[model samples]
Target: MRTAVCSGSFDPITLGHLDIIRRTAACFEQVWVCVSPNAEKKNQMFTPEQKLLLVKAAVAEYPNVRAELWPGLLADYAMDHGACAIVRGVRNATDWDVERELARINADLHPGLDTMLLPAAAEYEHFSSSMVREMIRYGQPLEKYLPAAAVELVRKMRTELNREEA
Candidate 1:
């Protein structure tokens, strides 16, 4: 089976992330949506477990896709899983710059693994997890930004957080 690994922090899986996963699933027989940590990103709204739950819910429709937590290096994860490629989503020039460098590093770490950058679809080009988090903090509607499968879970989590804060 041709497997591809798609790694991201996914603090709360957004529709854009789902779109990329769907596209990747079509190209590869097996796709692993690895929810990895980002040391650079602090004050994450969701825990790793919460993130995994959100990812699972967001990707439930894709039979070829599996969501899981990955604590180690992404290159290592790809190598361990025997992934032929590491799939990444590119939304804009800034994303391109960052993903390009990461791809180079991953290539260095796992010479056999190739990186495939899929450009975001027009509707999802502007959506990102960080933006979703900001919307949540400000009490904005999330129906448009998040996947239908994950919107309710995110709303439930928000309600729980509100109760805790109150």
Candidate 2:
């Protein structure tokens, strides 16, 4: 079976991320979303466990899709999870250039695994986790890029933060 893993920090998954996951899910026999916790990232709004929960909830409709937490090396996470390939999304030329090199190096190191870059949907080409956080921070509408549930969480969190400040 062709098992592919989609790994990302998924601070709060956006519709763009959802688009890639759904599209890739149709192609692979099974698709696993690995919530990668980036220790180097300090501005995270949600914990890794929270990210995993959100991913699991978002992907519950797809029986062929499963969500899990990945805390270490990405290639190792893919291999350990029985993923024959890693499905990555590219939003622009720069993203492709960077991801392409990483893919080549990952293949060389893993030998048995491969990486596939899925182009972002037209509307989602500019959607990003950092952008989502910024939107939430600035109180901009984000229904187009995120689901209602995620927006609600952002709203609640923002309100609570405001209360704390007050």
Candidate 3:
């Protein structure tokens, strides 16, 4: 089977992330949506476990897609899973530059693994996890930003956060 690994710190899986996963699923027989941590990011709204749950919910519609929590190096995960490629979503030039460098690093780590960059669809080009978090903080509706399956969970999480702050 041609497997692809899509790794991200999906604190709360957004529609844009889903879009990339859906596209990747179409190209690969098996796709792993790995919810890994970003060491540089702090004050995360959702824990890794929560992120895993959200990712699971967001990707439930894709029969060939599975969500996993991988704390180690992405290259290691890809290697262990027998992935042929690492799929990444590029929304703009900045994303391209960053993903390109990361792809180079991954190639260094796993010579056999290739990185596939998919440009975001027009509707989802502006969607980002950070932006979704900001919207959650301000009590903005998330129906449009998050996948239908994940919106309720995010709302519940938002309520819990509100209760904690009160």
* Best-matching candidate per lDDT: 3
lDDT of 1 by residue, 4-109 (tens): 9998999788888888999999999999989998999987999899999999988888899998898999999998888999999999999999999999999998
Q: lDDT tens digits, residues 28-54, model 3?
A: 999999999999988788989989999
Q: What overall lDDT goes with each candidate model?
A: 0.91, 0.85, 0.92
Report backbone clashes per prediction. 0, 0, 0
Q: Looking at candidate 2, what is the lDDT of residue 163?
A: 100
| Residue pairs with backbone overlap in model 3 | none
TM-score of 1: 0.96
In angstroms, the error of model 3 at 55 is 0.5
Among all windows of 10 consecutive residues in model 1, the one with the lowest summed lDDT is: 11-20
Off by over 4 Å in 3: none
TM-score of each: 0.96, 0.89, 0.96
Q: Give the total clashing residue pairs for model 2.
A: 0
For model 3, what is the error of residue 30's alpha carbon versus the real structure, in angstroms, after optimal superposition?
A: 0.5
